[model samples]
Target chain A: MNEEENRPVRWNLDDNGVAELIMCDRERNNLFTDSFIDAFLGALSEIEKERPICLLISGLPDVFSGGADKETLLDLCDGKIVVKDLEISERLVAAPFPIVSAMQGHAVGGGLVIGLCSDVMVLARESRYGAVFMNLGFTPGMGTTELLPMAFGPFIASEMMLGGRMFRGSELAERGVPVNAIVPKADVYRRARRIALQIADKPVDSVYLLKYTLSSEKRKRLIDARRNEDLMHRITFPMPETRRRISEQYNE
Target chain B: MTKEEVIEVIKRNIVENLDDVEADSIDATKSMKEYGANSLDMIEVVSTSMRELNIKIPRSELAELGNIDELADKFMEYINKG
Candidate 1:
């Protein structure tokens, strides 16, 4: 397919001033490829200019995102790119307005962290979520360390990040992760839209102000966590074992 | 079910979850990695196998298993608890 047709992300502002960003690179399961990242950043820029009262991000029916693309990870191992180049997490956290992530499908590694960075998150009971960076023999990145703990409790986040194990959304809900809602997969987008509409109903300036105030602490924590995570990535991403794992273990 | 049966269930699920893998080709002594089962695929296999076996083992407990045989052993441990 041509480049434009291949772009994996798109966004639009509704009449109520609720912007929806949908990622649907089904062929690749929405993994963060170069084109996907470029389209994501471009969409975010447009959405910011529109100044929607709230933004809702969603993905395909079965796979929200697969996180860092396997090719990208291999590049990092080969020194072709740096972890800092993946800037989606920072940009997502920096949006002046609130975000609602409707993760209706499996999300792994940086993918799961993207949902965690949002102001409101709706997960699917049957979809799996994980921080599988360690499974690839690298430390977690994209602000996962801080955001996961903030969303789920520190203890559960520790188990997820350290063990690199997948947890079904139902399992996470049972464990009391502090997400807004965990419903059947069919209802995830609907629930997130409801919350986004509620936010959109508020005065734009008031909603923006409240988002600014509420996310200030989180943004600051993200800055600190990013600094530490960058250091860890530098040390871990280039290891022989890490390279081996990425080469041997990365599927699709 | 016996441990051998558990291994067979795991092997079937591995074939189901991973691309280009065959049930007959899976070696109980080898890690699923040898069959090109990535982390996500492994999780799917484990989850499906657990569901089919009617047991629920914490994923964390299964993370360090070295081979299909070990995974079956772990499943057997949970199954025998009944």
Candidate 2:
């Protein structure tokens, strides 16, 4: 396969001081495989070095992310890896520059939570987004318990986390999801680029400081939520039923 | 369309969305889980079925459905109303 086909995640810094991290693991539907995680974190590290004023994160045309890989979940269930091993969400929350999540496709479970960590978000009306950990027979993880409520409000977050139902972006807009914009799928990336460019136009220091100030409280809450979620995962992830679900219910 | 037709639509969508599952083998009395349909697969099945049937049901309302039969019944209710 060519490099584009081989690489799952890639990043580049534009002249306008806006960096883009694009996930394009088409064969895997952007699932968080081990290589994908490594590439994602490595790209983030490289992007940070560029000192971009803003960042835009996106995925393939139809899927922002498919969330945790089934094998990863099975490893967690088998006591081979811990929940903290997945650090994408933590890195997103800790990034120095503001992030615009250009989720022009489906974002499920941890995928949606990571997008929720962004300073701003643009979603596609046709794409589905959900906190679907409960449907996989496990408690929410990757700081989702805190981030979902922060992004979608308390009651809607409760319904999503508890029900584990996938909601279309239009439905989420109707239900008052506080994203920056819910536009046509084709417009999602353009809208996000506009927001990112707007942020990039500001003085770099001012934008950085603003992002830091805005996300500080959220970062603190996420730390606590991660701790609590890890505890819950310890209790819930090892269930025989959860293992069964991971083995049988996972489709891709 | 009748309730049986609704069930057929649902079954057709399920076969299209899920892997290795055939409509002939699908048991209406069993949950989609029994047919190895994951949560995402179920969502696709329900969404496509609703699109084909020209019905819209809130996902929350469909969360507690026990089996394909119950799903068909719920779809029938909306179909009758429309």
Give a tens-digit lDDT track for model 2, residues A98-143: 9999999889987897698899999987678888898778999888
In model 2, which residue pairs have backbone atoms overlapping below 3 Å? Answer: none
Model 1 off-target regions past 4 Å? A1-5, A83-85, B1-44, B47-82
lDDT of 1 by residue, A1-252 (tens): 776556689888999999999997878888888878888888999999998999999998888898987789988888775543348888888899999999998899878878978999999876789998998899998888888888898999999999787887877888888899999889999999999999999999999999999998889988988899878988998899999778766532
| Each candidate's clash count | 0, 0
TM-score for model 2? 0.79
Candidate 2 per-residue lDDT over residues B6-33, each given as its tens digit? 8999899877655568999999999998
Clashing pairs in 1: none
lDDT of model 2 at position B64: 89
lDDT of 1 by residue, B1-82 (tens): 7888888898888765555678888889999989865556677788778888888765567768999898888988999997
> What lDDT does model 1 reach?
0.85
Q: Compute DockQ for each candidate against the true complex.
A: 0.10, 0.09
Model 1 chain A lowest lDDT segment of ten: A77-86
Off by over 4 Å in 2: A83-85, B1-5, B8-82
